[model samples]
Target: MKATTLITVLLGTGSLLGLAGCADPVPEEPVPAPIPSVTPAPMPPKTPLQASHALFDETNLRTSNTVPTGGAAFLAGLEAAGFAADTLETTTDLTSVGLKAPSIQFAALVDSTCLIGQYGPGDTGYRSVIVAPLVTGGCLVGESHR
Candidate 1:
């Protein structure tokens, strides 16, 4: 081989070996620990009044009134919340029944005990049979007994 060619071949080999020697031993990075899948706690069940609030948009029955507006506001609230308005059956005597949707029966009796209105010892001006939402199942459709 020619001298120049021989030198060129040696130089090429030297350059290749020099580049190979420059290779770094790749350091393995530490893998981050996997985060555990955290499930959130379920919400607690709502009470009758709370459930009513959630289902209805408004309540006409004033808990403090001696004679609530025949629970009109309360019934309206129930409809707003999501219950079927017609499914709720009510009477002035506080004996009301509702077809609790999805499979549940609801009955509520509004009497002196279930009265939403308040009264003083001598005050009898507002003695109404108010129809209020059932404390347990669904909407409330009621009327005034007075």
Candidate 2:
């Protein structure tokens, strides 16, 4: 080929090569808005009650109890009070006791008051199991339902 023709071809190829090296121009996505920091609310204080206070009652005890009705939060408080993590059991049969221990079987009332369990059968009705502070935890000793 002629010198001029060859020079033109080389210039065209160089220009094409230079264009290929350039980055693609694309509009970037907008950055997402930053999430607001969350400050968790302080936990409420837990009140440990008597073992009898933890029993199952039909009326007053039920009102003051915090176990069955308080849901998981209440159970958590029990654990905080030293109840074992593996000991908690949920129930549906209302007549079928709610919570128990080796020495005590009881039902919750409202917040942390009423507890109804077995001392025996007849005349020996309700029994109270002592539950110390969340520090001492709950010590259960007795025969539970099979």
Candidate 3:
């Protein structure tokens, strides 16, 4: 009876160990899909002043009557158009260029590029918008009346 009891206990223990081995492996925690990296959209390219220059080059520069009137207005327009306000320079005295009207000359340095604009009493709108290399200060693209 003792021998039979011992054999039964051993068989039971062996069966439990074998069952444990056969149990399904803890399903490997489903590897979470690698979170994709998010990248920001690139900014749109800056438009060159080609259109403004073309308008300036036209025979009748005053095609538009909606130009800013005074030096202050012109400077404000430049600031609104993404120009650096600190780099802006404006002067009413056109004596150096012999412009008779109470003209306003404005220049702004943007991205190491110089943009010059001229507006005055007689002109319908901005008379010129010139884009030039930084070397040429400002107002070099349009007629200076000199």
**Model 2: worst 10 consecutive residues (lDDT sum):** 137-146
Per residue, candidate 2 scores C-alpha lDDT tens digits across 1-146 of 69999999999999999998895878799899999999999886545443324322333233224434322433444445555445442222223365432223433333323232333333544344333323323222332221
TM-score of each predicted structure versus truth: 0.26, 0.22, 0.39
Query: Evaluated with TM-score, which candidate comes out highest?
Result: 3
**1-146, model 3: which lDDT tens digit per residue?**
99999999999999999999999988876878998998989977546655433432342233224444556655665566556677777675445567645665667665556566665554345555445554455444444321
Question: Cα-based RMSD of the predictions, in order?
Answer: 16.5, 15.5, 15.8
Best by lDDT: 3
Number of the candidate with higher TM-score, 1 or 3? 3
Model 1, span 29-92: residue lDDT tens: 9899999999999998986655543323223223223344334434444355455555433334
How good is model 2 by TM-score? 0.22
Rank the candidate models, highest TM-score first. Answer: 3, 1, 2
User: Candidate 2: RMSD over Cα atoms?
Assistant: 15.5
What's the lDDT for all of these models? Answer: 0.42, 0.42, 0.58
Q: In candidate 3, where is summed lDDT lowest over 10 consecutive residues?
A: 55-64
